[model samples]
Target: MSVNRRSILRTTAQLATLTAAGGLLTGCGQEAATGGGAAASEHPAHPSPTPGAPTVLTPNRIPAATPSAAVSGAPSAESAGASPSAPEQPPLAANTPAEVISGPSDRPQVALTFHGQGDPRLATALLTAAEQHGAKVTVLVVGSWLDQQPQMARRILDGGHELGNHTLNHLDISSLSADQAYAEIAGCADRIKALTGSIGRWFRPSAAQFATARVKAQARKAGYEHCLSYGLDPRDYADPGAEVIQRRMLGSIKPGSIVALHMGHQGTVDALPAVLEALQQRGLSAVTASQLCS
Candidate 1:
């Protein structure tokens, strides 16, 4: 299905039900597969980065805070309440810059980013293809999707890629009030932190595809320095044939471009090999968004 704003909003309720149901199914499958017991340690906590070692900064080139520190800065769910126009407070003083449209133009690299809330198999396929081609891409995951398949976060991180937030339920932040907006951003950040020991490196507003000033501020408050937007969108969510997707992406790509693709679509999975090959032919390497920006 095409995932334009109107369609996303229209299907929001249905998607919520699907996500919840999927989570239950996933939990059951895990129990059965693991002999009906939770592993003693599923995801081990990531150790603190060694001092003087290079850290992965947000696209704005700002250092990210520890997950605990970031969560502390965000408004608590209880504080968010039910009001729409809750007074906006400035995020913590340590908040990073707001948005990053594209990375530095001087490099012969581009970032391929996927917005995922679909089949985990397709995500694995996409990641496998990138790895085969000596590439790494960014994945901005939906919180509910992660709730369904928490292991996907570890898969992304373990593959030496990056992950970020795409909100809890793919809501259009533009239509939401400040308090509600903070919940969406922070809610997803909380999920990422639980799995990966920190919120993923970037935040991208869902459904609307671009962040409003208020939304950006909320995201910053949630500890994301970069609100990632794309320079190239292949519209893979539309399920255009693989050939069309490959053509549009290759045609639109430039040095430092951030290309937006989607998960759940077989076409995107099919298109990736050619797309990566085309990038090589153009002497442009595909990298994680932070790597492209850095």
Candidate 2:
């Protein structure tokens, strides 16, 4: 994925245009997620699901506002993530996109992502694989899953992994009505916020690789500047053997690629070591989605 001149200019302009007053995130636009309107984009708009992915600038971080209370007994660190000490991204301008699929190809990094809701042991095992290989990952979790496994939230952020919303029920978000879809997104956000201080960072629509325009709009209303999409889907969820998953990922991965995997499967956990080794062989670092996209 070569850098697009237009995207670079757009990024520069967006950075320059951010009002000193707008703060980290702007309010939701007039367009409703379920109601019809043009889809919002940050950069490299209307990207295809194919390999030629977009090269994006650093996306803004989630609003640094008070976390909405949803659960109690959360530790201070979980209430306020450890990563906030890092430099903050500039505020988003009006009409930022509701989805992001890839990052700047100029960097030799790839993001390994998981859809949360699996065996806790398996989840920790996957994280161990990444940590052992000196990698970081992103987890987009279902809101209700967090409700069941609140400790996992602290474990994820503590392990230097990114956490985001994957909707409440992990349902077919695109097909739901506007109100239902926003609930799916905001519901998870509240859950994440209850356990983790920030409202997480990114939102990914469930049961879909790419968000529909309506889903994007709904995500925006839910306070997500971008709904995360992936550039690579090795289909680890298919329960193929570890070797098959490894082969598919190594065969198709590229710089700035966001590779989607799942938990609850031993094969995916088994495949991580080889995949991380293969990534090293290809001179690609396994980074969090925030690092890759930023």
- Model 1 over residues 114-185: C-alpha lDDT tens digits? 886567788889899999999988898866566556677777877878889887545556766776666667
**Per-candidate TM-score against the hidden true structure:** 0.68, 0.70
Model 2, stretches more than 4 Å misplaced?
Answer: 1-97
Please state the error at residue 83 of candidate 2 in Å: 12
Model 1 CA deviation exceeding 4 Å by range: 1-97
Q: So what's the TM-score on candidate 1?
A: 0.68
- Global lDDT of each candidate: 0.68, 0.69
Error of 1 at 231 (Å): 1.2
Q: Candidate 2: give the clashing pairs.
A: 79-197, 98-227
**Which ten residues in a row are the worst by lDDT in model 2?**
33-42
RMSD of each: 20.3, 16.7
Which stretch of 10 consecutive residues in model 1 shows the poorest summed lDDT?
A: 33-42
